[model samples]
Target: LLLSVPDSTTGTISVTGLNGASNPSFLGMFTTIAGFEPAGANFNNHYPMQDNVSDFHLYDIGEFFPIQPVADYNAETGIILPPNPNLSGQLKEYQIEFDGFEQVHVDVFGLVTSQNGPNIRTA
Candidate 1:
């Protein structure tokens, strides 16, 4: 049976299974062109996992050197910041699972200037 589902560009996606099941088995794969994947994965690895600024740390210091706003930063600091110069990164994609549903989030993170450049001293 075909299930009718809404087209939500950046939100959760829910679909009904053949047996009226809400959480259907799902398999997903991600592929990227030559250098894009590494670039993205690298960015993702550096991307800040914490959403709080106070959660950032650099060698025992519980604050990002020179300090930065969470709304403007994407990666963790003091871990060999990328030399992208001008400081930049992308969202690539993300997955969220809840209430028997998995939502894939994809969007560009755009761009923001880094308070501390990749060469900025963090001591």
Candidate 2:
């Protein structure tokens, strides 16, 4: 999920994963920049930030600084299951809430495991 904040205020965003049989896991959130060509064309770019090792000075560009989340409740390997009386059987629901600042872009990463197999997918 890509979120673009228009104002300079603190806010919270909620992400939910609904599945009939399994609960999806919420991974870490990250900020990224859009790649652009000099001729005005846009392209995909992969610039990963290393935790505790990445230098923001080398990647910072004016107002396009990295936006970090204030509080992430699901930034771990734990499974989140919200209480819902409407759900039954193997059905499960997961919700992740995080705080963010204004005038920034964020990406919410998540992981979902396949119920039929051992394969896992990223979202």
- For each candidate, the alpha-carbon lDDT, in order, equals 0.27, 0.35
Which 10-residue window of candidate 1 scores lowest in summed lDDT? 53-62
All candidates' TM-scores? 0.16, 0.22
* Model 2 agreement with the true structure over 1-123: per-residue lDDT tens digits: 334443334556554555532333233333233221123323243232322322111111112113332222355856555644553323234354556543334433223334546765432
- Which parts of model 2 have CA positions greater than 4 angstroms off? 19-123
Instruction: Give the lDDT of residue 101 in candidate 2.
Output: 43
- The TM-score of predicted model 1 comes to 0.16
Residue 82 displacement in candidate 1 (angstroms) = 2.5
